[model samples]
Target: MSTQKKAIVFLADGAEEMEFTISVDVLRRAKINVTVVGVSLKNDYATCSRGVKIIPDVKLERNTFKAEDYDALIVPGGAGGAKTLAEHETIQKLVMEFYEKKKIIAFVCAGTLVAKAAGVPHKHKVTSYPAGVREQLVNVYNYSEDRVVVDENVITSRGPGTTFLFALTIVENLIDVETSNTLRKEMLTHENL
Candidate 1:
């Protein structure tokens, strides 16, 4: 078999540990290459909200994502990480590049803010953790208000409570459902999601 395709998880100072790791881990377990990218303010390793420091796989200046390098962009939610990512000019540019090129964009938890800042316009439906940042996304429909809202190339989920669902949803987008289902079983996570 060929080597798995890759997805990138953008991180920064204060990335919520679980959101960051679980997102990357789920994709990895599904046999996709997950690249954890730490967009540090100091241009070095980023310290997670839980205190785990991670060295990014590539730097802002060195990334050759090209909108065709692999598959998707994953943004995990954390108050600090989201805040940092939202404020970074390079990240904004990269994300905009991703969006303009129609790459799959996945955000969970607070990561929605980052995506919104990159100009997703909230066109379809979206969900976010805590529900306070709805303003960032111009036209959002709460999933809990009804069903899981997936629009075009964008995917958003609530919070830690919805992380598993978020991961599976992303997998379904990046690859095949059979692969996603097999990995879901291996992780012992609900496929009903």
Candidate 2:
């Protein structure tokens, strides 16, 4: 049987380009099977916050996407994308199912807000984009200013600037520290400013 770890990243209109792409790129490089799912009712391409258009591997459908099939769930944040994800009932249900199954759930920037709206059990150490985002998560979680915070199955990060670390953290969780470090060095991520 194949032992590859599988991950699913949910994308919505206005998703932060860096956050969504970086996470998927890093995971794929680590040999993890990453599926990009566009969470839209229309089943079309998702437009990023910076205006980059990406066609997802599949469109998220209520009965089609199963949480148990993947090892992790990723949500990349942009103000509009996060809001859309938070308000999407199908996405919320998937988040809850992932949480219940104890699978890794990673969120970046405003993406963490979707977890809040999904009602994933709170009090975990988490971080997200500051500005208008921190206030909402601070009271609900053991919030931090760290670039990446991993508490059990939930992993979160700050914003675009922190996407590398966030994605690397997910790699470490789904794979191993050795693999994560290898990719970090190969990508010269350790030398980033």
TM-score of each: 0.86, 0.95
Each prediction's total of clashing residue pairs, residues at least 3 apart in sequence or on different chains, is 0, 0
- lDDT per residue as tens, model 1, 1-193: 3667788889887887787778888888877888877676464887878888878777665665566785788888888999988888877777777777778888887888887677666455777775666555544543433223467888887777778778887888878788778877887876556
Runs in model 1 with CA error above 4 Å?
Answer: 1-3, 41-43, 61-64, 135-148
Give each prediction's root-mean-square deviation over alpha carbons. 2.6, 1.7
Q: Model 1 clash pairs?
A: none
As a TM-score, model 2 comes out at 0.95
Q: Choose the strongest candidate by TM-score.
A: 2
Model 2 residue pairs with clashes? none
Q: What is the C-alpha RMSD, rounded to one decimal, of candidate 2?
A: 1.7
lDDT of 2 by residue, 1-193 (tens): 2599999999899899999999999999999999888887344788889989988988776438777899999999999999999999988999999998999999999999999999988868999999999999999999999999999999999999999989999988888889889999999997872
Q: What lDDT would candidate 2 get against the real structure?
A: 0.91
Q: Report how far residue 72 has shifted in candidate 2, in Å.
A: 0.2
